[model samples]
Target: MEATISLTSQDVTKQDPTALFSPKNPIPMETIFLSNIDQAVVFPVETVFFFQVPPTKASSTLNICEVVKRAVAEVLLVPYYFMAGRLNFNHGSNRLELVCNNAGVMFVGATSRLALKDLGNLSLPNASFHRFIHRPGLYKSLDETPLFTIQVTRFKCGGFALGFMTNHAILDGKSASEMFHNLASICRGEGLKTHVFPNERTSLRARNPPQIKFPHNEYVKIPKIPSLATSFTTQNQTSPSPLIFSNKYDHKLFHFTPSMLKSLKDKAITKTSSFEAIVAHLWRARTKVVFGNTDELSTVLFAVDIRKKISPPLLAGFVGNGVVTAFATAKVRDLVERPFCFCVEKVREGGERVTSEYVRSVVDWLEVYKGIPSTCNGNNFYVSAWWKLPFNELDLGFGRLVHGGPIVSGNDEFVLLLEGNGGGINVWLGLEREKMKRFMNHVFDI
Candidate 1:
């Protein structure tokens, strides 16, 4: 039997006057633009995750829509103040505009205990909610409308997971996590006990922005399509057409033991590097497994947060986009032709080049090139290690999350670092279908 849940459009507008923005609490305009830039980089692509909630008495009493609305309201209140006072950039303050829409929900009936393992293979409905986000659009305007999509799907186990697709420009992964926790809390009839308060003192101060020391001359470059130029010329050219990369693939997590880490580290002495060096070595090993003798170039890119790297640390709890740099390494030869240690060393050197000065330079360049059409380096792969970062400790109340995965919608070349509960590293890789299969076989020696 299939289970069903539904929601009717309702004007659920709740605002805190204290959270309202005014000239008295004006934020720098540059900050707003930077926040949008941060969102553009991280978002542009959508992120989705599958959750398995075992049937419980709590699941039965859940009113999915009400829970979501209340949670969004609470979360918005916190960020509203943060954006009003704390969000800053080289240009000005970053203010957030909230536009909440009623995205329809769904219901899936089941006859027996649902096997979540199978849900992993199940595809949800293909509606405007999924399609509209896949396309690109102008996202820099502070007044651009915010969108939230919520869908409730019943499982074979008589439980449900609320699937949400939110624009990252509006909130980061951590902020969204907090919002979800609050939503869950409100669903359980728990009063808003701990309200979100902006850490104004630490969060609003402006540190010296990043300055590029050694600008990359060989950044991945994409030539402008003449068609795009014509489209913009003929139409309203204020917003550039959005670019979407096709990303459909399978992924799994791999754990490396401490002993294994030690082995890799010890091996690195011959190469003269640290843990990241050894990990890069392993990454090459995996790459070789997939590519065989290919001569095509492959790249590894990782994020470098600029919050603390600046002269003075950025204000704490600023709650907007703060990322400043991305470290990358690339090679063209077949993985088998290179020594694993050599590849590791190259990656290490590249990562070290991303310094506070380099970050500042990037910010400066962005400031100068705000409206100019820029090209992105089309690389074979991208990897981000959030495991060592504070992503795991994003506690909004339901205890620390055991696992967190990025809900990326349109890029195939990506990797995420996750912290396991038992003190291990979880590496989630998303690759193009054919390449991913080959890569998996190489990793497992299957």
Candidate 2:
């Protein structure tokens, strides 16, 4: 059943959406060049953090939005000022760049009469949560789009939800987590004293005379058509569009306890980590249901942080995209019919191939191809593991964090592995209504 929610204008008020920077530490006006990895992800990634406060006298009158807005302006934005800028496509260079003219981000404040308990399981993905986020205009141009947008919605019980959106072109998961940690520290009045915020994009600059040493099979060149320039809208895009707004799929979560995880590792021929074991099982099961018994090829894609994998490693505090796609492929018959260990080995081998040389080759290949976008086929599956991220530790000085994860599963083919509350793994995914029923039944068959 769909959740029915109503938010009257009287219940929510708007503040200055452009005060995303600190006056003392003004953002410099300049264009920041981005790397191929940064350009690959053109869409904004949406996530939410839930906090619940005790029924105390101080909690009733506290304005959570104002507090957070102050923290963001006076502290968070100082080191991460690029987030307050807009994305601009440089036609001459044929690459996307950030124009840092101090264009501030959008911040919203809202209130609801409903209590946090009224919402079903907070751990699960819910469409109703979309109301808490400030969705950017998809049709807007890059120059007009804000790099970040946040919304704070207070519940009747003094609890609140912080919905955040950031352009993936600006930073990856690691950098985003670093920003959150800094924000949390600043909110507690400790103030930020971390490493100098690294914004050196040219450190990963493409090799001169672009050397395509390795075949980057993960990417394919786009057919030369009249280039109408890059648009913010994801319409008519390739598989796995940036943002998903369809209601044709069902979002569900699966839990894997430590004991269950150990069982999977023990079953494998060689010892494997939790990620390898869990993803291998999910890939095999999904391939079986999605492709049935067939000889067609199925591929699994995930990201591997390349911060230290590259030569002359990126700055320790590097805050740009520093991840490369690692993928494994197998025929449907082999992936489904074989034992779980086979898929596990394939996943492990794919990740192992991302050495320093391989990372360099990926960068050079993108340069040779003029930063062409990668395409995903129907048989491809994407998985992201966020169980180890420091989101649970983010204390904003208002309430304690109760739940945190992706706002919604982007697509049926995409799966997110997050840590459960009770020391287990929570696998959040979306699938067609009928297919989801089959997936849920088969998820634990191993």
Candidate 3:
């Protein structure tokens, strides 16, 4: 009733010689620069999930490892066209490394019931997956292998969870999800006839000869002694403020019923736009219960994908960082004293100001102050909601996931949102252990 699947380079090589490289293509100079920048950031870390069915008359008929092997083979056959063309750190002298060449798939063997517990204890190999922003020049390859790792364990209830790790520079959340979906579909005898092609066209291209408007110098202010902490505290202290939430971290996906959605919209209408209003309301609710203070200062930040919002839509399938906007707002007193709806309104206004021009301004600001130490306001609370977007539609064909949630990138100051099947929202909140407990009690009680 138990099994393990392991795949290696030899198995992959035997299937296809063209697994990682393309002979006829050359990447452009600009793409190399973009890859370098992406390597500098740390948010887009890669991971994957597999939902296992219990061994039954029907389930036992299929060989899961064979399915995964086929999936890996398929991914290898195609060149990570983008990575293969770009050089690491924009060094023209260095050659681009194929994405598949840099990455490999590992199979961890464990029982289904203990899967989650096992994954919870698993840390990404320090040797393979290091935080990009924390350590510069550590990873050498342009499409450097991401020290990919995989773990398979059975759930207590006779199911399983497949966990994976990869570097953020190679893929964004959306892209990684797509790859896993395709792999799953192909593994299930679906076959890989239709390539789940990455969008590389105009919807993601950079501004031709990208211009710097405000310049990095204008917005980036470096502090004399940089403090790694980026969250606010009730008092000035060296350590970041602890997040207030219960210790039990459970992932739940729920849909907003028509009435609930309508009520939320009506509440938001009085104060901010739809997105901000909802985020603000959630922030206030969670903070109130966890912090035990209506007046604790906090901020909510979200992403604004600029592919369509830019002057001219970016090139389609461009596959680099194209998100340009983040929104934030906070109030210790206003949150405690003001009506919840009012607070929601303020958050809405703050988010709306992050237009294409604003995004350009921020980038320009970064360009000007490239190496300067900047003081970032860590005291504000952070919230990101990307559920309404196409994240859940990442159907790799074994039937859309019943639930899919985002993993926290070691950021203890924020809450993120994702889409859930059956029309609900999945909220991921990371706070101080003590605070998390209180917040969970409040939410579950409600």
- By TM-score, the best candidate is 2
Q: Write the residue-wise lDDT of candidate 3 on 13-125 in tens digits.
A: 11111222333234332243332223223322433343534345224413443444445645533433443332233234231222322223334434332423333312111
In model 1, which runs have C-alpha deviations exceeding 4 angstroms?
1-31, 35-60, 78-147, 150-158, 178-212, 217-262, 270-279, 282-298, 333-338, 369-378, 386-404, 408-410, 418-426, 430-446
Which ranking of candidates, highest TM-score first? 2, 3, 1
Q: 2 or 3, which is superior by TM-score?
A: 2
lDDT of each: 0.41, 0.75, 0.42
- Estimate the TM-score of every prediction: 0.60, 0.90, 0.62
Worst 10 residues of 1 by lDDT: 228-237
Model 2 Cα displacement at 139 (Å)?
2.3
lDDT (10s digit) by residue, model 1, range 325-438:
354445546444665556667667766776666655554454333312122333334455555544333332322222334443333445555554455555655555776667
lDDT of 1 at 52: 45
Model 3, stretches more than 4 Å misplaced? 1-31, 35-40, 44-48, 52-62, 75-160, 188-261, 270-274, 285-298, 370-378, 389-400, 408-411, 418-422, 433-446
Model with the higher lDDT, candidate 2 or 3: 2
Looking at candidate 1, what is the lDDT of residue 206?
27
